[model samples]
Structures are given as structure tokens and as C-alpha cells.
Target: MPERTHVPVAIIGAGQAGLSVSWYLGRHGIEHLVIEAETPVHAWTDTRWDNFTLVTPNWHCRLPGYSYAGDDPDGFMKRDEVVEWLNGWLDTFNPPLRTHTRVTRLRQGADGGFELTLVSADAEQLLTADDVVIATGGYPLPVIPTFARTLDPAVRQLHSEEYKNADQLPDGAVMVVGTGQSGAQIAEDLHLAGRTVHLAMGKAPRVARFYRGRDCMTWLADMGVYDVGVQEYPGGQAAREKTNHYVTGRDGGRDIDLREFAAQGMHLYGLLEDGRDSRLQFAPTLRESLDSADATYNSICADIDRHIEREGIEAPPATRYEPVWEPDDEPTALDLAAAGVTSIVWAIGYRPDYRWIEASVFDGGGRPMQTRGVTALPGLAFIGLPWMYTWGSGRFHGIDRDAAHIAASIIDRVARGSAGSVVTDGATLATTP
Candidate 1:
């Protein structure tokens, strides 16, 4: 065994989440190490598409003591611009970051802390820390269905993260699975590029980009939708399971209308059910999914309408969205060769992977069972989970707040010499003053 290094705290990611935690801990003069398998902002730099942009405006890109300083606060930052913006934080505090380091195993230390087995550059190293913060974002592994292996080798397949542009695919129609943000956007990208597109739509909701003379998100922000707590949501935990509304920040911003895409010669299908070679089966859900998305869109419009009237804000006149296109036939099956779909993009989203974390703190779904980032176990916590506390918990808009609370909790534990007041269920962690 390599010599075990000891530290007061170890943050297991270097993304915005871990860096935000480091900023807060540094403020309190706490010593910690931030370890990353890649450089800081690895996901931003590596995973996203070339044209990828923040769905939220630049203003929402908030870290500790860092907010968008660019002139275009209302504009969305493109992929490279986002990378540059996030890299600015590395300069702001110059955190203690260890790149090219991967924690292969994390287990409870024999004596009152945590032990991490690391493999980096073909060398093994061991680390022990009194406290550990798992700040990796909720999505860890891109999930492609097992049936994907049954696809004919002639048909190229790529996950949404792997898709760069239409030119990267075979010179034929493209099929994009799932109607989550990525799927919708990628389908649109291919369609705009004049490539034939077959989109498998899901039940993901849609929101208008602009409403009543302002960005819908701006109104929602003012109405405190983003600040609504997990417990406060009417759907409760189910709200966290819902896919995010499909919209886009590409070329300024716009609402993704799958109906319009269908009108423009793009073949839209329902939820994919199974596959046999180049032939795939789909559920007869095209109309239902489209209606459901529009219902959610108009619902948000109605909520915003009421807010505008209640607050007497002089906003533009509002009207409900009527469906621009309707599906007359339910497309339940697709023959890839016949449809000329030479490529398929699996935009089915990702699953969380915490196998390296050897602890009892995770739920059945592998999510850390933490309340506002504090676990029931002493000296262990999680940050950057979707809806961990608020809608902004995993995004830049709220990482600072969550990190501050967790940092305060760590500080309290350090002072008291034991973890204090963390509970397994429905307990709120104290906010730092």
C-alpha cells in the first residue's frame, strides 16, 4: 500500500459543485483537497456538443463570489464560452485541485473517518480524510438501452453526449430517441442542417422561451419557482423524477416545437419500446406526448398570466398556445433502412453511478440519502443532486447556497468533534449565517 495521506476534508469532484464547496471551506480557513479524474470543468469542455449553450441565461451561472460578468447577462453562453466562464473560477481562488486523480474506492475508515483508494497514472495511492463531500453531479453514466446491441452494425449509434453535429453521422436520415432537452435539441439540429430526422418523443414537458415580454425563466425566477423547496413541491419526490422542460439556448433562445418539426418533414415517433436489428418498435404515444407537453406549456403560461395580473406588471398581452400541428397517424414502428435513418442518437439521459462509494447512505436508486447535502452518517455528505433541496441544487444558480450550508455543517462538526443533528429523513440542515 502506498503511504496514506491524511487531510481534514476531501471533495471528490472538481466540477462547479466541488469547487463551490472548496470556495466556502476556504472562507472558513478549512483545509481540503479537491480531486478530479480530469481537469476542472471537464464535462463542460469535453462532453457537450460544439453548439451546446447554457439553457439558462448567463446570469444563472453563479458560483461562490462568481456571477456572470460579461455584457450579455441575458444571453446564453456557448459551449466554449461556458468553459471559459467556468475556468475563470479556477483563477479566482486557485483552489487546491488534483487533476488526473480518480478515487476508485471510498470506504469508512477503521478509525472515525473515510478511506479513499485512488488509481492515477497507473500508480496506486491511499488517502484518509476526516470528512468527504461527494460533489459529482447527479448524472454520472450515459444510459443506452441494452437492446442497442441488437442494432445492425450498418446503422451507426451514438449517445446524445457523443453526437457533435449532423455531418458526423452517416449521409442519411437521423433518428433521435427521447424528447428530453438533449434529444429535442439534437433532432432540431439535424433538421436544421437539412438532414431528414426521425424523433422519438417522450412525455417531457415544454416551456415557451419568452412569455409576456420577458424570458419565461425570468418570470419564473421572480415568481420564486426556482426557490421552491423539494418538500414544498406538490409532487414531492416525484418532481425530482420528472424530465426537465424541453427548450433551447441555441442561437439566442427558442421553444422546441416538435409539432413544427413534424410539419417540416421530420418523422416523429412515440416512446421507443424495443428493437430487432435495424427495425425498432415504438409505443402509440405520439399524440398523447405532444398534448401533454402543450398542456404543461400552457399551464406555465397561465401561471405567468396570473402573476402578471396580480402584480400589475405592464407586460405584453398573453394568449394560450394552440397546437400548430397535430398528428393524424400514430407512428408505432420504424424500419431504419426504409426510413433512410442511417444513424441513431440515444438521448435517453443518464443514470447515477456511486459504486465506488461503499456506504449505507444511498437510497435504492443509488442517490445519496441526504437532506440539503448532509447525510445521516457522520462526516459524509453529498451535493449537486437534482432537487437536493431546490430546483437549482444541481445547477450553477444554487450550488453556492448548497455548498455554503454543507460547509457550515462541516465547520460545526469540526468544532464539536462529531457530526451533529444530521438525520436520515426529512431533516433540514442549518444554513450558514
Candidate 2:
């Protein structure tokens, strides 16, 4: 057995959030033990698609006090840039971290602190801490439906997480499912790569890039919309659902508009209304149904226009809607025979995997139930969830704000030892009451 260790703070997942927490803890003269399942920046270096670039521009890529130390702030940063930045941050902060060590379980100890079970090839290890930060991020697991498992074996299929680029796919027409940013971007890439593509668009809004021009996202942050549900209020959960709940693609990244997909010899279809049926029927009235998606589309396009004007460039005309590009709930029969797509890439979104954390902290849907980062149980905190605190909370631009708050909480908990203490000598504090 490996020698057990003890620390005042235990941090899980050395991603952006974990790094942020470590940096803050170090700044405050607090010692911490950070546990990462893989090498630093594993998700960005290993899991992301090859051609991926951040949707957020460089200028806003600020995490706490550290900014992306690249040449251009307005320019986009590739996946490698992000990875390098993370590694650089680690080098600078030099926090105590155990790589290749996966945290298998977290339990509340008799002392009301946290006990984390660690696993590796050689031996098991355990660590205790007064405060725990779950910075494991939101992309722990890919969401795959059971029905997708039953598809014909001849057809090659993969989740977006497994996809790297066009070379990873086999020769044939491709069917890209879902209409979110991933689906749209992947489908556009495949179609552009000389493959016949069929997109199975669900009830999703087709958004555009408006993030470049006016600092609207920053404006939203100032409006406190991201913090709306997180802070105590009536209908907090419901309000978060209305504003910041969904994963949307960066509209400013891709130029292939949904309205132009059909013109580029792409086929767009809809799912069968009968939830059980796999058969897809043609619905010619997609343009009418697409009206519902206008909110997302307009938001993106408006941001794009602002970007153009702010950059002092002549604004381009709004993308004219083609009648065929309209939304269709019931899509026409898609002829796979003609399309010759041998691969089906599901660009659907992600789901959190709380299996490693066996505590009773998650809801029935496997989502953690927390007041801010604080779970129902003490000594446990969740960091780096999208909109966990604000619109930019999960992004590089916003995670520091939440991390600072969480770090302050951890510092106070460590200092007081007892939750009942209502005062701290010289530090920011948080209380249950």
C-alpha cells in the first residue's frame, strides 16, 4: 500500500478549474493536494477534435490573474495553445499534484472532513482534507442513447468525443446527428470535405457568431444573469434553465450557415414525432418550424454584426433564408443509398459522470445538487460547471470569479475548524446561515 497523506485542501481534476483553485490556495499561503486522473490538460490535448479552436477569442481568455500569453488577444487559440497555457500555468504555480492518480471515491469521515480513495496500477492510497474541490469539469462522459446501440453493424458510428478529424472516418457518405454547435460544425466539415452529408436536426436553434464585436457576453455577465439561479432567489433553478442551461456552439467560429446547408448538397431531416419509432418520414414544412429557432439564430447574428461594426469593418448582409433551409419537425425520407455515407457521427452533447463520487450528492438525473459550489454535505464543493456561478463561470473568462469565491470558502472552513464560527480575523468568509 502506498503511504497515506494528509492535506488541508484536496482538489480533484487538474483542468482549468483545478489549476485555478490551486493558484488561489497557494496565493493565500494554503497548502493543497490536487489529484488529476491524467497528465495536465488531458481533455484539451487528447479528447478534443483535431481542428478545434476555442469559440472565445484570446482577449477574453483570462483565468484569474493569468491571461493567455499568446501574440494576439483577438485571434482564436487552438487546442494546443490551451494545453500549452495550462502546462505553463502549472509550472508557474507548482502546486502539489498527483498525476495518473484517479480519485475513485469520496466519503465523509468521522471528523466531518473528506476522505478520498485513490487508485493506481501499483497500490491504493487515501487522503484526507478539511475541504474538497471537485474541479473535474463537465465533460466527464459522453451521452449515448440506447437506441443508437442497436443500429446495423455495417454502419460505422461514433460519439463526438471519439472523433478527431475527417481521417478518423471511413470512406462513404456521412450522417451527422444533432443540430447543436458540434453537430453543425462536424456536418459542415464532412460536407465540405467532399462527402455527401445528411444532418438529423432535432428541435434546436441554429445560432450564429455574434461574440466577436460588442462585448455582449461581458454585458450579460454584468447583468448578473449567470449568477441569477446560483444566488438564493425564487425560481432560481427555473430561471437558470431559461437563460444559461444549454450548450451552444460559438456562432462566430463557422461560416457554413444552416440556411445554406441544403444548397451545398447537404440533406437536413427531423426525427419522428412518435418517440419509439426509428423510421423517419418527410415533413416539407421545416421552414415554418424553424421559426422557433430564430431566437438563437438572431442572438448569434446580432453578435456577429456587433463584432463587424466594432472591428470597424463594413457589415455584411444577414444570411438570407432559403425556403428549403427552414426547419422541419418531420423530415422527408433521406436516401442513404444515394448519399453513400458509411459513417454516422453523433455530435450530441455531454453528461456528467458522478459514479466515482459515491456520495449522496447528486439528484436522480445524476446532476449534483449544490448551493453554489457547496453540496448538501459539508467539505465538498463543485467547481467549473457551466453557469455554476455566472455566464462566464465555466469559461476561461469567468472561472476565476467562482474559483475565488470557492477558495475563500475553503480558506474560511480550514481556519475555523468549526462551522459555527461567525468571524474570521483577516480573510473573506462564508457561513451556512
- Candidate 1 Cα RMSD (Å): 3.2
Which run of 10 residues does model 2 get worst, by summed lDDT? 242-251
Mark the regions of model 1 whose C-alpha exceeds 4 Å error after superposition: 417-433
lDDT of 2: 0.67
TM-score of 2: 0.82
What lDDT tens digits, residue by residue, belong to model 2 across residues 331-401?
66654444565777876677778887767998777887876677877778998886676556677876776
Which window of ten consecutive residues has the lowest lDDT sum in model 1? 422-431
lDDT of each: 0.87, 0.67
**How many clashing pairs per prediction, in order?**
0, 18
**Candidate number of the best lDDT:** 1
lDDT at 27 for candidate 2? Answer: 77
For 1-433, candidate 1 gives per-residue lDDT tens digits of 5977999999999999888888877876789999998988898867888788778988888888788999998888999998888878778897898889999999999988999997799788999999999977897899999999999889999999898878899899898999998899888888889999889988899999988888898889999998888989889887788899999988999889888888889898889999978899999999999999999999999999999999999988998989889988998888998888899999999999999999999889887888888999999999888999998889887788888788877877776644444321112234232
* Best of the candidates, TM-score: 1
TM-score per prediction, in order, is 0.95, 0.82
Clashing pairs in 1: none
